[model samples]
Target: MVTSVAPRVESLSSSGIQSIPKEYVRTQEELTSITNIFEEEKKAEGPQVPTIDLKDIDSEDKLVREKSREELKEAAVEWGVMHLVNHGIDDDLLERVKKAGEAFFNLPLEEKEKYANDQESGKIAGYGSKLANNASGQLEWEDYFFHLIFPEDKRDMSIWPKSPSDYIKATSEYAKLLRGLATKILSILSLGLGLDEGRLEKEVGGMEELLLQMKINYYPKCPQPELALGVEAHTDVSALTFILHNMVPGLQLFYQGKWVTAKCVPNSIIMHVGDTIEILSNGKYKSILHRGLVNKEKVRISWAVFCEPPKEKIILKPLPEVVSEAEPAIFPPRTFAQHIQHKLFRKTQDALVSK
Candidate 1:
């Protein structure tokens, strides 16, 4: 019902402006060339890595232990994506979130539209999908309930979905779970780098600068799966993300020059490295590019929680040890704020990829 027959480019405001050339916009066909570099799926259109149920895996056993933490780092540095089986978040909580997401999105547009983004009217933002043109491919069948996670209390919580009050409770619980996992993994990263937890905290900031958005993506059964993708190929901007997905599969990652399917295990979280680690690790680790593909037979759901640096933290220079006089900085230091703004509004794949 929210479908727009044709997408139009929405102009930006005069403030906080930068002009990107118009020709940079790539169509669905053009996206294939970049994707082909890493994907093995031979469909004329996209990858079809199968999704697996997490209940089948024993996440209680870690592939690498605390003593061999370097192995953990090596794995992340090499793979950038991992499957977490024993994460232990309650199943009731997941179901609650799903129900709340469905309840809110199913509301009449008149009610939902009250919170819609109003660039023309200057109201800024609220719940719902990005403008159709924000994505190069035909849009995903997902609907989301988004809110700011930084500066914690500074957000206008009143504008959030009032009907799904329990959504706040469920999502906040998930945020805490994700934060705990991020810290646990950070400790491993510290060990791998031969640094201590305290040092790792200081290198970034003692602050946890992350955006905890509960994206409730719904994939209605599609008749034509190849004509469009659930999400286009792209990289996540956070240092890492903890994802909880519905049993229905479609998540795929570009890896080792082949597209590998990320099998979804119920109750397990998917850990993915983002762009920041590639810089912090001195390119020892590269963030993986991923996309969502829909199915003709099922509906899908995913909640991706992004763990990042604080907006005020300037990741401009590498930790002195990581970059020596002989080595150059991987990329100029930029604030989490700038990274966030670009993620929210930049209109093209080239905008993120070229830089």
Candidate 2:
């Protein structure tokens, strides 16, 4: 759907342009509303996004494990996002993932473009900057590398990066670990929702049919950071998203009427509830709106893996366990492919988003 062939944001930022092109400049009204809300909440000792320790989530002690699940449920219902610590992912492996991405982005422009994504042809895998598909035709100040990592056999290696000798190796290992972690979290959430531990997973398509896709976002330093957004505000379409970043904070969430900046916790992954989960929970849980902000002095990079159901097979809606005569299902059933189509072509407003 992206038709623009504009230069990559990384190239534009490095070119030392005195001001961003008009297309990238957001309207003054838009900037003021976002800027003013963030400033108003800046001085308050606002609530921080909940940080959950996963070390005891599976403890042999029954009481301890129950407490951990309760904490996880509370965070999910209240914030729709949380910081995960002691999540069993190796520190060294996390560093390797980060280095792999940095190496690829550091490649020569001509070399990097070799794997450019052909969005024009309906292919989303590979590297490229998605330009101006919005009403204003404004470009986001970010470039990204996206590819499928799970359903391992479905991986199209041709579009994957080959220059970073260990890119595939590191990312593959990371994806494997994240799959297990996400499954564990989903089980806990299901139990908290009063359903069988495996109910949610089954509804989303069991491991054999689950889909995991990774997007490595690169936000370059902008000369006029306030005039442009690193990424627009939108909720993910998947069930869950696990994010790893390089210790630079730029992620923001719309919470309790204010934009809250998520502070990064070293070695901790940020987890987000996506639209599928909200619909499946029948409004018991939420998928919040989030956006990224650009920095004037530093580049910010993040790796986000979206865990979802097989695109066409799973019909997402409220699970029978969550919906009762007293609590009706607010969302209608729809396959993931249909959901994506509506969002992509602007067929209609997505029902999954409450606002």
Candidate 3:
């Protein structure tokens, strides 16, 4: 099991090197002193992505299903993101998950560290502050915990939170619901690509190896919100990501050559394509760049569930049906593991350069 480290405050000037704790409530002075290298000059007007009601797709009428498919396809190609409504997940379950996240994050730094990320072993399924290496001493102004929920054998219970009493139960139920939804979404996307609904799922090893990972992000209020970023600009590495964020507006997506703010709709979940999906669709779909902004007064919490193929080695490439003489494959065939590793390395390099 990975050991947790307590947050320690050292008396250092703004210009001097300082070590920020993995999870701690930041003081007003400390929040103001942190440099924001990701400040933006202007924000976009509104959400560029469209919203789709899943109920439309579930309708008994064939015409309704077709229309919903068309709308989803368009959103996938144009924005690579969308909001999902009537997704069938219980509101109470969502509330439970949120409460559990809050409980865990509210724990003392030392307690939280008990499940620190095992970086030495390249395991990220635990509490951590940054995903990429901070060789240049620059980091995002957020704390997060990552864990795998599917493929039960692959889960490390040691890293799972024991406190919050119902944290495990709540997360487990949430994961079950998310898995079913993801499978349905993937089936719809396959139909949108002019293939059998189950084709894409089968190619990725179906339910057996289906990888479902969850990330809970906590962004504390920053005194100088304009000068700091909760998370840097980047695209997800999974096939698809479903996110539930509170009303605090901070999520932004890069669209039409500008950064547009993603507005939160009550009880709605945001869904977005990831790099793997882009590759599977042969450039027909997109994986957009997004980031989290900080606020001066409100703390933000978000739960993101990432869906991908099973762990067994599988080559990821655009389906043949989606590619032809008119549209050739744009990406080379690569194993899923290889693709993820390459993306992580590139992100680390980019982060280092930015610092």
| Candidate topping TM-score | 2
Considering only N, C-alpha and C atoms within 3 Å, which residue pairs clash in candidate 3? 4-113, 209-310
Quote the RMSD, in angstroms, for model 2: 3.2
Instruction: List, residue by residue over 283-338, the lDDT tens digit for candidate 2.
Output: 78779899888877678999999998988888898988888899999988899998
Total backbone collisions for each predicted model? 6, 0, 2
- Candidate 3 structure quality by residue, lDDT tens digits, 276-338: 889899978889998787765577889988887754478888888888999999989888888
Which residue runs of candidate 2 sit more than 4 Å off their true CA positions?
Answer: 1-3, 33-44, 345-355
The TM-scores of all predictions, comma-separated, are: 0.72, 0.93, 0.85
Model 3 residue 22 lDDT?
36
- Ranking of models by TM-score: 2, 3, 1
TM-score preference between candidates 1 and 3, better one? 3
lDDT for every model? 0.59, 0.85, 0.76
Question: Of the pair 1 and 3, which is ahead by lDDT?
Answer: 3
Off by over 4 Å in 3: 1-47, 131-137, 348-355
Error of 2 at 71 (Å): 0.6
